[model samples]
Target chain A: MEKATEELIKETAKDIFFKQGNLHATTQDIADAAGVNRSLLNYYFRSRDLLFEQVYNEAVQSKRSQLDEALDADLPFREKVERFIDVYLRDMRKYPFKEAFLISEINHKDFVLKNKKKSAKLISFLDEIAAEMKKGTIRTMDPMHFLVNLFSMLSYPIIMSPLYQQLFNLSHTRYENFIDERKDIILQSIFI
Target chain B: MEKATEELIKETAKDIFFKQGNLHATTQDIADAAGVNRSLLNYYFRSRDLLFEQVYNEAVQSKRSQLDEALDADLPFREKVERFIDVYLRDMRKYPFKEAFLISEINHKDFVLKNKKKSAKLISFLDEIAAEMKKGTIRTMDPMHFLVNLFSMLSYPIIMSPLYQQLFNLSHTRYENFIDERKDIILQSIFI
Candidate 1:
């Protein structure tokens, strides 16, 4: 019973904080959303701040692990890059505000930085690119720039879709298709 | 004196609304920030919402015109693209939250969509891309896809810089430098 309640609280809290953009959600708001009493929140997570921290940490972890595993996987360089973009776009689509919420909370005093473990994951991705560059499969450029370009291509469309939709007068279907259309262009941009 | 008070109120309202993220800023907040009584805000703009609308409209107008004039100019295609990216990066730096803020307010129940004038501006940009495509200077693809790539490369980094900085361990200077390095690669990606 206690385990179920705790999981319920966490799921509800993630929905509220991440999906709903209720960064200021109080214990009552979360408890109410979860359909549990206020005391249950305290019993489960102790405080609103702690609940938020746990949720945010899990979100960041899950995202990093997704990328780390994809990049660290044994696959052709372009294939891995394509899979990375696909997973990222799907995640962004699922949690439309995830990136925005992350940006807002990234600098908060209570936000913990937990990136010491990511470097080990990044090395192989860089090495793969270096090998390709040596073979002239891709242009000789700083791997960091290549990574940044790849990420920028994937994320900006998702984040700024609303504005661009209006600018281009695109219907809802066209907007989604626009994102679906980026994989080829992004790969061509990365490889020579 | 009247004109000065109106300008002061508008400036304060923008600082409060956009920079400070004070979407719910009251008349009192604007008056306090501008060192004027709440009455002058209504006296000049008749309501806080009107002042906000005017400021938001002017911002969009100025931005569209900047792009319109730049694209319509008779510069070489690559040079024009470089200049546009430069101005865009400068603007994003000046108002880091402008795009985010615009996205949020763009869906406000009372928000007006004024994009009819922009199509005229965008036509020349599309024509230029088509010209390049015909000349084989750039690959043949959907003009829309080409544009989405161009914008995604330019914007995603600025919008999601905080997350990437933390993940990549970039200092402020390094982050800025990363954006500066993208221009050459982005142009290369667009043109053969």
Candidate 2:
């Protein structure tokens, strides 16, 4: 019962924090939204600040784990990348404000988004990239550059979707479609 | 003298808004930073909100003008693109927080960033992109997709520099070097 209540509070907090843009949302707000008491929220998170930090960390960690899965999957290199893009696009649609929140956090705050475990995963992903380069499935270049290029293509449009819409006079529907069309566009650009 | 003071206030407000993330910085703050009195700021801009909107619009307009110059340059398509990348990289380094500030404004606020003149500029850019495709100087594809891909590559790395640093374990110096080297990587990927 306690674990379930704690999970509920955290999930509700994530929704309210990321979706609602309530960075300063109070514990009372979380409790009210979670249908629990304030004390229960405090018992789970100690403080609002701690809750926010945990939520941010969990978000990054979850994304890292998903990348780990996609990169570690026993698929061909291009297929693996395509799967990763699929996951990335789906997540971007799910959490439309995520990149904005991340940009603000990274730019304006002293919050250290540290993850010792995820560093290893990043190295592994890079290693997979290097292996793909060796196989000539991807162009022979610095593996790091390839990784950066792939990520830039997958994320740039989605992160700047609104600006793209504004710049191109694209409605929301067209903007979303533009991003949806990027999978093949990105893949075609990357693969030989 | 009055125009200079107005420019000073505008520049100071931009510094506080983008660099310091003080979206709600007061007229007094701008005046103090500009070394002018609050009445002078109000006299020039009429109100704080008006000042902010002008600052935002002017930033967008300046960038659009820069792009117009680059796209209109009488160079070959590839060289023209390289020149634009150089301009973009220089501007991004000059104003690291611009994208973050833009993202926050676009995502969280009701502000509409409108510029009727710039819509014509975008059309010209697309026309240029289409011409390049027809000449086989660039890949044969939808001009809109090419523009999106080009802008995505140019802006994404700069916009997400801090996050890229965290995720890739890049120190500030190394991360900068990575971005510096991307002009070729991006251009080569785009052009035949």
Candidate 3:
């Protein structure tokens, strides 16, 4: 029961911070969201900053693990990218503000990744991208730019959805449909 | 001198919020950054919210005008894109956190754009993109996706610089060079 309560609190905090885009949500807010007494929350986490740090670390780890899984998957290059987009967009739909939260934390808190070295998976993924380029399947450029371009298209529209919905005059349903259409569009844009 | 101080406070707030990515900066922080007393800041803007409103409005206005200039320029489609990239990147280099700030405000504050309608300029630009597709100069996709892809490639790298610098193990100078190289790369990715 105690473990469940603690997990509830952490999950509630993630919902507030990641799903709702409320970077300024207070401990009281989390406690309210979790239906727990403020003292109980404090008892479990000690303080708001500690709670936030745990959530932040978990968010980073989850994202890194997702990337690693996609990169290390033994699939064709195109299929690998398709799998990556599927996983990434699934997470984005569930937690639209997560990337925004991550970026904000990095900007405001001087957050540093614990694993500073580039992962072997990522290095191999770059090599795979380079190999694909050699086959003239994708545009020839620095492998890093290919990665950047892939992530940029996949993440940016979702991150800026609030603003883009207004700018493009898209209803919520319409905007979602537009994003749904992007899977193929993105694939086509990359390949030839 | 009075006008100068007021301008100084606004500019300093912009520097803090847009350049430094300190979205949570207090009025006292802004005043300190401006080298002005809190009372002086209040004297000019009446309240911190009012000061923020002014800065936010100006940032939106400035970005809109820049886009308008690029879209409405008489240059060829390719040159116009090149010019847009140049201007957008130049502003981004100066105010790296501006888009993050804007998106956060929209998400957290229920900030509706003053101009909610799709601009005539943006519509024409979309038309222009469609025309380019017909001419076989670019990949065929929803014009909206085209715009999203363009802005994504342009902005995401800069916005995620703090995180990306660590993730990719890029030195500050090397990252800047990477971004500098993106203009040509973005053009190539867009134009067939």
Candidate 4:
């Protein structure tokens, strides 16, 4: 019951913070939404900032985990890159605010600077991929460039949805199909 | 003289908004930074939001102009794609906040949705390229996918700078070199 309640608080806080942003959201709002007293939120998470950090970190790690698994699988590097894109895109859909939350945080000077765990796990995974690419298991390209491009192609639609809708006259109603249609286009763009 | 001051104010306001965000920045902050009085800011732009809108619109227009130029050039579709990447990257460096500002505004859902001049220009250009691609002047891939990937490869670095740094353990000191090196790798990613 304790774990369940804690999980409930976290899910509610995550939704509120994502929709309202960090500064705009209040602890009481999270507590009320979670169906818990304000003190329980602090008791479980310590503070709102700490709670948000947990959520953001988990979201980033979740996506990283998916990517790491794909990279670690017994597949050729070319196939890995293809599969990585698929996995990354699928993971991104699960966390719609992930891009926006990340973008807002990244503007700060030390936003992700202190998170050694995330940094290490991701870099090690990248290094392994880079090593394979170096051996020509993948086509010749800078691993970093491939990494950046792969993510951008995968994440750009969600991050830049406003620009797309604005420029293309696409309505909010069309967003689902628009994004679905663009997936193949985005993939082809990178691997064509 | 008036045009230059208007330009200066817009530049200053954009820098402030892009770096500090909407909540922390004040109109006086923009005015003082631009070496003008608050009244002058109001006289010229009416309000902070208006000033921001002007800069945002101009930033979009400038990027679109470069894209249209490269895409509409008489070069073949493949060459156009390469040139588009080069020109877009070069121009983006001049306005680092373009992506961030746009993303934030998009998140807020505060901006008016209207047809961008660039949209018409770009759609026509892409349609023409699609025609050529259909004729086998370029390899077979959906045009929209080609576009999504091309932009992702080119723009993802700026858009996701924080995530990139954290995930890869990259230092800000090496950012320029990192992006410069990626150009070739990104180009190859598309071709292969």
Best by DockQ: 3
How much of the true A–B contact set does each candidate keep? 0.39, 0.33, 0.70, 0.42
Q: Give per-residue CA lDDT, model 1, range B20-113, as digits (tens).
A: 5444456897899999888888889987678878988877776777667767768888788888888777776666656655655664344566
Query: Highest lDDT among the candidates is held by which one?
Result: 3
For B1-43, candidate 2 gives per-residue lDDT tens digits of: 4677778889998887666554445688788888888998778
lDDT of 3 by residue, A66-143 (tens): 999888889999999999999988888888888778877776735555548998999989999999999999999999
Where is model 2 more than 4 Å wrong at Cα?
A: A1-48, A113-118, B1-6, B19-48, B113-118
- Best-to-worst TM-score order: 3, 2, 1, 4
Candidate 1 lDDT over residue span A80-161, tens digit each: 8888988887887777666655665663334556656347778767777788889997777788777877887777777677
Give the Å error, residue B191, model 3.
Answer: 0.5
User: Scoring each candidate complex against the real one, what DockQ results?
Assistant: 0.36, 0.38, 0.69, 0.38
Mind giving the per-residue lDDT tens digits that candidate 2 earns over A61-80? Answer: 77777778877778876778
TM-score of chain B of 2: 0.80
Could you estimate the TM-score for every candidate? 0.82, 0.83, 0.97, 0.78
Q: RMSD of candidate 2 to the true fold?
A: 3.8
lDDT of 3: 0.88
Interface RMSD for all numbered candidates: 3.8, 3.5, 1.7, 3.8
Shift in Å, residue B18, candidate 4: 4.1
What is the C-alpha RMSD, rounded to one decimal, of candidate 3?
A: 1.5
